[model samples]
Target: MKKKTRTRLLVITACLLLFGLFLRGNPDEIIPFGLVIGGAALIIYGVKNRRQGGQPTVLPIMTKEKEAHYLESGMTEKEIEFFRETMNQTKKQILQLQENINQNAKLKAIDLRHDTLRASKALFKELVKDPQKLHFANHFLYTHLPNMVDLTDKFIEINGHEIKTKETYEKIEESSQIIDQMAALIAKDYQQFVADDLEDLDVELSIAKQSLKRDNSL
Candidate 1:
C-alpha cells in the first residue's frame, strides 16, 4: 500500500475504534482478532482499487509531455475510450496522442460551430418573426462570426489537407453541412457530425492497433 493508502487505512481504523468504544456499554461480546483483520483487509482492498485508477483515454494520442498534462487534467476511462475510438487509424498508442489533439481540435471546432449556428438559427427565426430581433442577431454575428468562420475555415484546412483516407472529403463536407444546419435548421445535418465524430474516434483507434506485423500497437 502507498503512503496515501496507509493513511486512509489509519483513518478508517480510527473510526472503527471510536465506534467500538461508543458501543462499550452494549453487548459484552469480545471483538475477534480474525474479524478485525478481515475488516482491515477489506478496507485496504477498497483503497487499492480506488487507487488503481483506469488507464488514460488521451494517453495513446499524446506526446510524453502532453500525456503527463492529460493525466494531470484528470481524464475518465470513458473519455479515454472515446478518444481512442476517434483517432483509430493511429500507428501506436502514444502516436495516437498527436492525432487525438488534432481530432480534438476538430471536434471542438464542430462544437463551437454548432453552438454558433444554433444561436444564429434561433436569431434568424426571431428576426423573421420579430423585426426587433435583428439587433441581437447583428450583435452576435458581427461580434462572433469572424471567430466562428475562422475556426470552421481551420477545420476545413485540416480536413482538406488530409492526413489520410479517401473518406476525408466526405467527413469534412458532412461537418460543414452540420455546421450550416445548426445555423439554418434546414434539413437535419447536425446529427451527422456528432455521429461521425464518434465513429471516427473509434475508427482512428482501430487503425492504430498492431497487426501480426508489429507489437505494442494499441
Candidate 2:
C-alpha cells in the first residue's frame, strides 16, 4: 500500500473511533480485521512457492556458425593437416608396397630359369632310355621349358620396368600358375645335385693326386 493511502485509512479509522457514537461498528475492530486479511494472503502466497533460492535454468540459443567456431577452437591447424597428409601418405605407401611385392614375385620367377635348364638336361639324359620315352621327353623339353622360360622371363622383363603385350601377359599368367610349384621344387633339387657333384669331383681329384704320389714313390 502507498503511504498516502495507508495514512488516509488510518485517519478515517481514527476519526470513526473518536466518534463511535455516530458509527454502529467499532473502528478498532475494522482496522485489525483488514490487517489480518492482508497478512494471511501474503503468508499463503509465500508458502505456496517457497523453493530455496535455486537459480532458474535457461537454455542458450546457438547457431551452426557458433558451433563450428567451437569445434575449430578445439582443433589446431597442424593436427588437422597432419591427419590428412598421413592418410594420403599411407595410401601411397600401400600402393608402392604392392608394386614391390609384384616385382619380387617376378624376380623369383627369373631365378628359376637356372633350375629349369638343369632339370631339362637331367630328364633328357636319364629318363628317356626307350624310344617312346625319348620322344615324350623331347616333346616335353621342347614344348614346356621354352614356354615356361619365355613366360616367366616376360614377368622378369616387366620387373625391369618394361611393358608387355596382352598375349605375353596371358602367357605369363598361365605359365606362372602352372610352374609356380615346379620352379621351386626343381630349383631346390638341382641345387642339391650340383652341390653333390662338386663334392664328388673334389673327392675324386684328391684320390687321384694321392695315387700319383704313390706311383712316384714306387
Model 2, span 45-142: residue lDDT tens: 45543543344533244456644543454535554344334334333433432343355655344445544544645643433122223233333444
Q: Which candidate wins on lDDT?
A: 2
lDDT over C-alpha atoms for residue 149 of model 2: 53
Worst ten in a row by lDDT for model 2 = 127-136
Off by over 4 Å in 2: 1-115, 127-132, 162-178, 181-218
TM-score of 1: 0.24
Where in model 1 is the C-alpha error above 4 Å?
A: 1-105, 108-114, 163-218
Per-prediction TM-score, please?
0.24, 0.25
Task: Encode model 1's per-residue lDDT on 100-206: one tens digit a residue.
Answer: 32465654554465554454344344333333223433324343443344445555565757374667767666766655543333213233323545798888777
